[model samples]
Target: MSSDLFDDVFTLEDRFYTEGYNQGVQDGARAGRIEGRSFGMEKGFEKFLESGRIASKSLVWANRLPKNPQPGGASDEKCSEACTLPPLPKNPRLEKNIKLAYALVEPDTLSTENSDEAVQDFDDRVKRAQGKVKIIEKMLS
Candidate 1:
């Protein structure tokens, strides 16, 4: 009878332990998912913000490019007065770099999905755009 009692006690302890372990596992899984999602969202926002900044800079550079005055056409005196900034010099290399940078971060071309392939492509394009921007800055300076 004593041995049977001891066995029942041991069995009860084992059952409680198993239940506790299972509960812990479930809770851990839930917490992990929440944390992962939060991290992903933060990183995605940062990447998009950086890309947007680069794209805007490229657009401003493109707009500042000198306009070719057509023969017998009226000069854009109003534009010159409104835009206090001088036009960028006409350089093929500079123009190419500006266009490439803009294309790299174009919203329509970039994917917003969180898939691995999409993330990798986004990162690659942003990196390449950053390099191009640096080169363009050096050239301008």
Candidate 2:
């Protein structure tokens, strides 16, 4: 082939390669955003469920214990009504859970840029925090 023709072909190939790469990058970013959104939604559901479980689980066991009785009604514990309830943050597990849950809910933390690996990092942290929360809950229970 002629030199001019060869040069033209190389230029076109380079342009096509560049365009493909740019498109791929754009697609990856978009995909990451969509995936991250779905993931965050799932995490929100999980947080709600876990929070409910943490708030209610201890109460389950606590209630099962025998209650004091008066002549007519169950005897009230001497402690204040609020004090007798489960502790806030549910427990130590819930402390970590609240931390992670708040982090997940924050908008900035859910970034999905293609080159940033935000999705992977967010997912990893969430999984790790969840595992830790479960372990803590088991210990508490």
Candidate 3:
């Protein structure tokens, strides 16, 4: 009888332990998923923001590029001298860099999915855009 009683106690303890472990595993998995999603969202927002900044800068550079005067018509000045920045000197290298940077971060071409391949492609494009922006800045300065 004593041995049977002891077996019952041990069985109860083992059952409790198993239940606790399973519950812990479930909770941990849930928490992990939540944390992963939050982290992914934050990183995505940061990356997109950086891309936007690069794109905006590229647009400004493009607009500042000197316009080719038409052969027969007078050049139409769009901005008043007080508001306008002096046009950027016409340089093939500068023009190319600005276009490349803009293309790298073009919104329509970029993916919004959370897949590994998409994330990697986005990162690669942003890194290349950043490098191009730095080179353009140095050239302009």
Overall local distance difference test of candidate 3: 0.90
lDDT of 2 by residue, 67-105 (tens): 445777755565446355453433544455545544543
Off by over 4 Å in 2: 1-5, 69-141
How do all models score by TM-score?
0.87, 0.44, 0.87
Residue 98 displacement (Å), model 2: 18
Error of 2 at 77 (Å): 17
**Winner by TM-score between candidate 2 and candidate 1:** 1
Clash pairs, candidate 1, are none
Measured over all alpha carbons after superposition, the RMSD of each candidate to the real structure, in angstroms, is 1.9, 9.8, 1.9
Note the residue pairs that clash in candidate 3.
none
> Model 1, poorest ten-residue lDDT window?
62-71
Off by over 4 Å in 3: 11-13, 80-83
- C-alpha root-mean-square deviation, candidate 1: 1.9
The digit string of per-residue lDDT tens for model 1 on 1-141 reads 899879978799889999999999999999999999999899889999999999999999998887878689989788899997788989999999999999999988999987899989999999999999999899899
